[model samples]
Target chain A: MNHKDKQIQSAVQRALGDKGLSRRDFLRLSGGGALLAGAATSGLLYPGTARAVSTNARIVIVGAGAAGLSCATRLNRELEGAQITLIDRREDHYYQPGLTLVATGVWNTAKTLDSNRRYVPSGVNWIHDMVAEYDPDNNRVITDDGRTVEYDYLMVTTGLQVNYDQVEGMSEELIGQRGVGCVYDKPELAERTWRAVDEFVDNGGVGLFTRPRGDIKCAGAPLKVTMLTESRMKERGTRDKAEMHYLPPGASLFSQPDADDFLSKNFPERGIQIHWDHPLTAIDPDAKTATFDTPLGDETLDYDFIHVVPPMSAPDSLRESELAAQEAPFKGWLEVDRHTLQHNRYANVFGAGDINGVPIGKTAASVKSQVPVAVENMIQAIQGRENSASYDGYTSCPLITELGKAILVEFDYDLKMKPSFPVISPYEEHWVPWVMKDRLLLAAYRAMLRGRI
Target chain B: MAFSFVGILAVVLEFFRGWFWLLIPLIVLDLVLLGLFFKRTSGRRRKFSLPFKASIGFGVFTFVMALITLPGITRSSWEMLAGAVDYLSLIGASVGFGVLFAILAFPVMLHMLGIGPKHKPESQATRQSPAPETETGAEAEPSTASQQPQG
Candidate 1:
């Protein structure tokens, strides 16, 4: 054989061998090869080696969540000799996307647990403290421990917090007990939720799933948990024994029109009742009753199992800060331009992730799309130039419909479907999207954290 | 149900369009490698097993493609056998891609081996001619052998 033919023959024989390489070694080799190719072509994996702009400005990022870590990695790579300080007391990084999966008993809690230290790039100042005050006028922030740090540029990415107090008598400790479950934040909480779901599915009962008022992270999460719980009961042949109800705070079930239509029709077909314009007000854990504030009056209902999704808002520090918007609609959130992602009043301040007061896009997919734009705009401002990047509000959600099927719903500010894979239709339930949610998204999320697309 | 070749072709095209940038270069390289392979096996065609070699090449290529795209399957055995639907879908997708790849690659492989498209006989004399039948049969033997299920 010729040289090229020999190489081809040898490679095929070696790959098909039974004992040449272990599974882990094979994965590392192949995954590394793909990442190397991506790095060479897109400069996303190893962006620091590419052309970096020189700057000495002190950049401070306020969170170590998905958006904050992504910003830190991108900024550290694109800017040289810049003092980047990441301020967040969180050492454990939770893969928030997988929380729903864990809550439904599909994934182990360990799969969603990771460390922030793995993604936080070296050469950046890591502060193990939370910001207590945001003083934009003085261009400085005071931490909870009374340490004042001044920055020439500020990137606010403090993700939203869930307020369990809004639902009276409901608390985190009540999860996994008394037929109460909530699939939000913290892998432990998700695991606890799974225990409740497991019990409810085996011994069928009246299950109440709720959605709160205003914007929330992963708006589809509550819906996913409800559907997955129903699916699990169906899988166990206990579906007929259970009565389910979905309570949305508003008339609409989803923000996107097509999805709302599909879900509005889908829920009833599956025998899961829908109660619109019902915002959850209180939950009496001892009495096993819940109250909803409706248009007519207060309505209370007894439940064998209840999912308590609380109203979410910006962190207390940022919401009460001077940098927050002081008007209607987007009040009490970080004041930022929808496109540029820069602070409206403070030129040096920028916001990303859930803290930004944009019309939509509060998911991890939005963080992936927003980090590059925000980093590019910050670099341009550092060079004393106009902002060159604009965020189009791209966000995606793999809406799991059943145990093994999902609809990959992707959209932008216009609420128009923008599917990444043409073969997978955005409107239909398919296994391809379920596979993406179950097996692919977590890796993609990690890549985003590393600023590797 | 009657099979629609055009529909399957469209499905394959839609599925692969995302990887066109990589597919184009790999296709060009395949043509080059086939050229070299054809030259090396021209005189020894009867001695070498073309079906075995082609199957090996295609199987390895499809497997590498799967590994590159779906890394989670190799993370652990739990990922592969987690749920019956998930396990079956992963295997089904890999096999489906292989079938589509074979459909796309067979024509190139045949052409590289000097087996062009079949032509209709011009007349009854030509149709009954032993010379034409022998020539066509000789060229088609390897193609038919390669198309057989290897597993």
Candidate 2:
């Protein structure tokens, strides 16, 4: 081609670029990419204006999980002369968000196990014991060892408990045996689940992935496990021999409406059966069966491999205490103003992480967003001021549809989509979202754990 | 996950256990091909050079495949070399994916939106070469006409 042809081609390219991507679209996409990239790489979008508030107040944060550690880190750094104590017996902090990756064979179990000592901050006191009782009335909490620790302000970041016994004939020991798998607990449990998943993938058979009724941490994990198992089967050329069933506890596969609709349509297309409103009530591992409490009646399904997600709730101690909500729906959950994250009746008490009674987002991402609110409000309380920071119930799920594609579904209290990337369509499966999940989100999660984001 | 140095190391090792190993050669070969093509094409350029275009097209494909293997590079980085290997790997893989988008994906996308070039316009391409930057449009038109008789 001569120079004239090159000129025409250049003109055509320019025209195409100019018309196809207008300045507005270009700027929006560029800006969104920059924000996500910034959040992913530098951990700069922390959304907090931290200033050390000098006080002699006693600050107690329960649990040493993501939320607890984050709050403790922020409080320890931003408060002066404050006696900050974090109470939790856990030494190894399990990165719960990565459990799905471990179970799906993408990540090793070691990837999930982290030492809590690394994140507990220097100035804060670490109480290696569980809070057996929360006595907000007396402004004190009793530890399992019978120590009554008083606090000027209490942060209940105890996370939640997995009720494996709620599913009849199921126990923690049953995982990795009899084709039973549960990814909600420890790193070992997720690794054990992988053993069952690996065998099922090799020897093609009935694979049942079930989610229980009510809230669960990292709600998208069950879906990811199912999809990744399917991906593995496809990769191994065993998809033809295996049958997969996803038993979500409700009519919708996910809480976000668009994501729910997408999953509803996408699941059947991939030959995975969706049993609507079929919450897993029990599983007899020895018999290789799962019983679901359908709206019509009890329905039993035979499975060679099953991923069990048990019903979750705030620990019994908190639920039985005054801190829990006494009303309907959010009963047994930490009763707090959803926006302020402060205890409804007690201003000194606050809730973070999975224990909070927020409508959605019991995720690491939620903890990242909520910790700022809870910390800011607690600081405000220390300053004898009204709560200023508010949590918007922000939750994000990188909903992986395949090994290489995902839809990043992010939303708030209203369930309206709030996409960080303007170019990546929230409704469609794309590699960028998958990259975000497989690579970048973990970095962001780590950053958030350190209170950097 | 932990995102600690050890956990990152495990993730990188975890990648090698899968098909990620195949992407290594695909990407190495792609870069080599791209490097040679660009070296030859740097002096003058046109819309189509079969070798350069094909290199870019396959380079895009290999680059995308390499990109999918990014979790390995992203998770773990060496501090000894001051992240030299880490950054180079990331930049190389990302650029490959970027080229695929710019050349192949954009054209198809633009065409779908009815903005991409469709006409061949043989007259424009086969006629005398475009005038230099110094020449005005008015002068170029008459020069083309006058040169037609001379040629």
Candidate 3:
């Protein structure tokens, strides 16, 4: 190995504490790097051979996000002679859940953004293109560049598309104005949001945070921003100077009962006014005002700062496909049986994470529970055995009520409370949960996403 | 006969004890109450609109089948379902209780608060479309050029 490689290995060994590059880890890193380099250089691994010896059955995965990468990792481990290809439009993969912390100045933007190629498991092919058409009948998907790839199995994890156009008189251009920002969009924009918040504080203006209607990736993120922003202002001694408003489309602070009580009671003390059942309808950037459709009536509020959480929906590729038209409520967010995490139509196909149409809250914690279930079911199906493994619909929401206190709400399939650690009660906000949120969750998230867990 | 068989098995499991007598009447009362609830509620119609209706139907079907085929299955199934109901009711009671406490504790009436104004939709027709390209190879920028300030 080269000197630089030696240094990296040494550092990794030190970091991992005597694990000393397991055979699995070495193969994964080297194979993944070689495949990426090969793809970039020659478009194919071997010049003369049509297919590599390592790849037998072709597996296609849509989206290079958390779910797609996790699925690819599991498939690589389970199916040894399998050709896996992951396709995504973007060059960078983002840790989307961290955007909440980024908006509140708790995390830097660079921490959340990483190269998409860094996470793809070894022996998997990377196709950097948006899917143009999904023809499930023939078991093939066409790319925007007119390249058609046939696959024995297809896993769709495109998650959600941000619909910024839904708000009247609001365009993408309106962002980063006077004090306008959104944590739900691009992770890179989060730093700019912090700057906007800082400016809002300096200018003695009202900070308005909004939550739009429909299914967002992390439902608690908007409130996270609200609480963190309030805490930041208190630290800055600007709490009394600037007003804060949290406008949400939902009737309550949180979908979980325990979380809702904590937020409703504690938020008022922080001088945060919550406009429940109020959804952002329009934004007058020039006038520095935002209009919302409240349950009572329509209201336009003047604000120095505006942070919008855009309405999200299933990815267009999945929505337009024939698989989506099958018996389901929404489009084909992968028609996986909730328990088995296996596609109802095609047994080979499986899904995990936010893309699944389960009623559970879409969070990183939800993906942690889903990965094991998907892997178990996928392995069983591959071995021609009965797939008895089931997902419990487990999800967690760490509601950061303040800088030092958080209410960790965990629940299962039936919305039954499932706390990870025994606390006084699941509803009570405590400092230990907050510490877990700030310190341990990142390590857990990285490990879980890498499928080490 | 299936119900009697399951009931008899329950009686057997209870050691043919007098406690089994109480269970029989309770089971009958539960079945009667469930039937009454279904009959009185508008949700009994087969033309259900919600997505959860199918799952509910499947759960009920499984319960009925288990009760008919095996007494043990019926007892276990009933216990599990009852446990789920108990948990759900506890959460519901907590929320309901909290709401009641909030209402009673707060002096200000909820109805007294003034309603906020409504949001009006803008006219889309008058909104300017993208500008046409110029001959000088310069793209004409929009009239309202609001550049985002760099951090």
For candidate 2, what is the lDDT?
A: 0.79
Model 1 CA deviation exceeding 4 Å by range:
A1-47, B1-92, B95-151
Alpha-carbon lDDT, every model: 0.82, 0.79, 0.67
lDDT of 2 by residue, A1-453 (tens): 999999997886687597897656767888998976664433332323354789999999999999999898788778889999999998998888888888988889877788898777887899999999988889999999999999999999999999998999889999999999998879899999999999999997899999999889999999999998998898789999999999988888888888988888888999999988899988887789999999899999999999999999889999999999998779999999999999999999998989998899899878988998999999999999988998888888888777766787889999988776555568776655666677666666666666766
lDDT tens per residue, model 3, B47-143: 1122223334444454444334331221111222223323343344345444433333222211122111221223431344433554321223333
Tens digits of per-residue lDDT for model 3, A23-86: 5787798899897666433432111123213336678888877777777766776676877888
TM-score of each: 0.74, 0.71, 0.64
Q: For residues A188-235, could you state the per-residue lDDT of candidate 1 as single tens digits?
A: 999999999999999998999998898889999999999999999978
DockQ, 0 to 1 scale, candidate 2: 0.05
> Stretches of candidate 2 above 4 Å error?
A1-51, B1-93, B96-151
The CAPRI category of model 2 is incorrect
In Å, residue B72's CA in model 1 sits off its true spot by: 14
Error of 2 at A200 (Å): 0.9
Of 1 and 3, the candidate ahead on TM-score is 1
**What's the C-alpha lDDT at position A42 in model 3?**
43
Query: How does model 1 score by TM-score?
Result: 0.74
